[model samples]
Target chain A: MTSMDFLLLTKGPLFQIAIAIFALGMLVRLVEIFALGRPHNYAAARGGQLIPGLKTVYKRFNPDPGTFKRAPFDVIVGIIWHIGFVVALLLFIPHIELIKSMFGVTWPGLPNPVVDAVTAITLFALLATLIHRLTHPVKKFLSTPEDYLIWTVTFLPVLTGYLAYHRLINPYPLALGLHILAAEIFLIVLPFTKLTHIFTAFVARWYNGAIFGRKGVQS
Target chain B: MTEFSLERGLNALREEMDAPVASFFSSCVHCGLCATACPFYVETGDPKYTPIHKLEPMRLLWEQEYTLWGKLKSKLGLGKQVTDEMLEEWEPLLYDSCSMCGRCSMVCPVGNDIHYMIRKAREGMVASGHAPEGLIAASVRAVNTGSPMGLQWKTLDVQIKHVETATDLEVPIDKQGADYLVLLSSMEIINFPEYLEAITKIFDHAGVSWTLSQQCFEATNAGIQIGSKDIAATLVQRVVDAAESLGVKNVISPECGHAYTAIRWEGPNAIKRAYPFKVFHIIEVLDQLRAAGRIKTEGKEMDRLSMHDPCNLARKSGVIQQQRSLMDLVADNFVDLEEHGKFQWCCGAGGGVSSNERAEELKMAAFKRKKAQIEQVEPERMVTMCATCRTQLEEGLEEFNMDIPVVGLTEMIADHLVERDKPDDAAAKAGG
Candidate 1:
């Protein structure tokens, strides 16, 4: 297919299919987790759980002092990439416009230059994490094939989008088509891989908080 | 009894597959931050000691049985099964290296309770006949002889008599309607008879009615360390039965971390019923007495003192402030380790590691983390509330040739207690 035809295919039916699989897959995974159903704590609680559970959902974004001191680079780069990725995905004008087209909703977007700088920084941070994962002994040992695979799928959308936006690739349609295809692939693979952490991290944090909170700890 | 096998182990893991475990495994991103939080990995620099990696067998079983992708893979013969051999290889990882300290759980960016998973994973290890022999023997002794160390009530009775003679105070036994029913660990009975004396003096001074039961004086639960709920429940039921029969208002867990965790937190859940009375760690009780203006003290210890927070007590049970409050009551120069309270490094002897003879070298290796923390502070003496932590601290410091002595917070508090007047002096002074 020509570049224009390829762009049309990605933005039209392929995007819808990708979104469907992404949503349904994540739903099933969440159901599987929740259906397991934690047993009721028969022991008396020393503190309230609901507030602590909610607190931990937000608190875990920042690393504890010991953890940060132990692995400063990992914590700093992890925070930077996460914040940069979200900003680039949601605050860029074209992405917001795409979302508006898909869901009939729109929000004000950041200036193109600002979004561009964030995407570049995010790409660098992702690369740094990948290198760390490959070199850090514990991370290297813990990593599986899925870890590298997930990292690539996560990295490609940002890398290709930045390239397409700057028109670094030769043909505009070809670069744009590649970017959209990369994002669609990301969505399809996300719920199936460790990337499910995007949603389940909150659940995990809540459980951790509730368990410790019942014992009057702010974990 | 049926012999332990891989099938039983897999079944046990299946039983442990609850929502928290599922969420924790799903949320993990293999960042290996848990290793940084674990003392075993921090001290030995071994990637194999990573907290999440230690739960590999249980995690594999969870994936194969619970998830769609894992099920599909298993059906196609592409899934990894938890084999007996795999569990055998993992015994040290699960039992020797881990103290169930929960620091990893605290530092996991995604909030995976890695220590909780380790505790559950041990259930599988024991069922598969892969548990360390020391832990198995301890569990057996605890179940049969009522103490993991195989000490009898007569052993504790002798300590009680010694404490009564030393302090010249009554040592109440099976005193019905007492305010507190005290439990003791075998470590305290054998290694630190002074614990009984300190409590006796403090109780007498505070006018608190307390007694020790002849039936179930032992508080440490081997089942808890061995990761067997059935055994844990049986041990817990013994304490429950003893307390109920005595009709005490509360049960006091002695200066042992796992004992406090066992009876105070896990006891009710293990037996599937709420406790008729309450449970408190000795520090918590002392703190309460201090707060209520019941226990009066006259002096502060001048030594440069620091504390070792027990994992089960500080991190797991949230008894952090109680020990600190008790310390403040008697310690004038108390310095905290760089890492204390819920984030403190474990003494490396908890969760049955001290019981497992094979884990001796590993336990010392883990103690290096705590040793480093102590070296940073350079305290003259280290104080702690848990008996197991105290023992480990004493042994580890001696092993390293550190001059810092270890003391129990309770005993220290007892030493500083204001001496009360005799009945004759009180009456004569009132008349004058």
Candidate 2:
């Protein structure tokens, strides 16, 4: 198929399928997790749990002092990529326009230069994390095939999106089409793969904080 | 004897799965941050000891039995099957190498409770009969006898006689409606009989109404250490029954880490009921006495001193400040360790590691972290509240040829108790 035809297909039925699967799969998985339900704590609580649970969802954004000292590179690079990804997704003009088209809401977008810088830095951070996983013995041991697969899918969209915006790798339509397709793959696999952590991480933190917090622990 | 099987192990993992476990497995980013926090991983540089990695069996079970993709993979024979051999290999990682200190849980970027998962993973380990012989034996003795060390009431009665003779005070036994019901660990009875004497003098001077139950004096729970709720509940029920019979207002957990956690935290959950009476660690009780002006001390220790916060007492139970408060009253030269209180290093012998013979070398190796922390402060002596930590501290310090002495905080407080001017001052202290 021509790049135009590929673009049309990704933008049409493929995109819908990806969105549908992403949404439905996330709903089902989340329901399953919550449905399992927390075991009733018969022990008397030492402190307020709800506040701590809510507090930890934000507190985890910064690594603790011990963790920071031991894994500074991971912490710094992780923060960069997360911030970059968020910026690229929510603040870039093209993404903003796409959201506007779908949801009929509009917001201010970052300038092209700013978006370009973030995308480049994000892609670099992702590559650095990949290299770290390959080289670090502990990380190498902990990593599974799914870890690498999720990294690839999560990384490609930014690469293709950046290439298309800069008009470097191929024709604009072809690069843009590949970027959309890569993103669709990411969306489709997110709920099924280790990437589900995107939604579950906060929930996990909340529960942890609640459990330990009720016991008056700062965990 | 209970038969061991792979099916039993897998079923235990399945049974332990709940909301927290489900979310923890779902949310682990595999960033390896937990490894950096774990003393075993940090000291040994072994990836297998990584907190999250130690739960691989449980994670695999969760995936295969719970997740759709994992089900599909299993059907196609692509999923990793949790086997007997795998559980056997993991037995050391689950019990010996981990202290359940909850440091990994604190450091998780995704807030996964890696330590809690380890505790749950051990349920499967014990069910599979892959648990260490030492811990299994301890648990069996705990259930069969009243103590994990197989100590009978006669042994404690002898110690009680010794304490009464040493202090010239009666060690109250089975006093109805007493304010406090004190418990003891085998370590305390065997190694530090001085603890009983210390509490006797302090309570006498402070005029605190307390009693020791001949029926249930042992506070340490092998069930918690061995990771069996059924056994833990049985052990806790003994104390509950005794306390209720005596009608005590508060039960004091001895200077033992797992004892405090097993009784104060896990006890109610195990028995499936809220305790009729409140539980207090010895340090908390002392702190409360100090706060209420019931405890009066005349002087502070002049030697350079530091504290070793037992993981269960400080991190798990929030008894950090209470100990420090009591310390401030009596330890003038006290300096805090670099990682004191909630972030203190384990003495490498908690969570049943001390009971497991094979874990001895690894436990000593893990103690190097605490050794280094101690060296940083350069204290002449170390004071701690937990018997397990105190025993580890004494042995570990002796091994390293450090001349530092380890003292129980309760004993230290007792050493500084102000002498009452009149016989009736004891009554006035209690009244005031």
Q: Each model's DockQ?
A: 0.86, 0.80
* Model 1 misplaced stretches (Cα beyond 4 Å): B424-432
Candidate 1, A1-219: lDDT as tens digits: 999999999989999999999999999999999999987677878998899888888889988888889999989999999999999999999999988988899999999999999999999999999999999999999999999999999999999999998899969999999999999999999888879999999999999998899899999
Candidate 2: lDDT over CA atoms? Answer: 0.89
- Model 1 lDDT tens row, B1-432: 258999998888888889999999999999999999888888899899999999998888888888898888899999677888899999999999999999999989898989889888988888878889999999999999999999998878877777766777779999999999999999888888878889988888799999999889989999889898899999999999999999999999999999999998888888999999999999999999999999999878998999999999999999998888888899999999998898999989999999999999989999999999999998999998888888898999999999888899889988888888877544322210
- Model 2 Cα lDDT, one tens digit per residue, A47-164: 8889989888888998877778889999999999999999999999989999999999999999989999999999999999999999887899999998999999999999999988
Q: Return the top candidate by lDDT.
A: 1
Q: What is the lDDT of residue B154 in candidate 2?
A: 95
| Runs in model 2 lying further than 4 Å from the true structure | B424-432
* lDDT score at residue A150, model 2, on the 0-100 scale: 94
Residue B357 of model 2, lDDT score = 92
Q: For residues B170-263, what per-residue lDDT tens digits would candidate 2 score against the true structure?
A: 8999999999999999888998988988899889878999999989999999989888888889999999999999999999999999999899
Q: Evaluated with DockQ, which candidate comes out highest?
A: 1
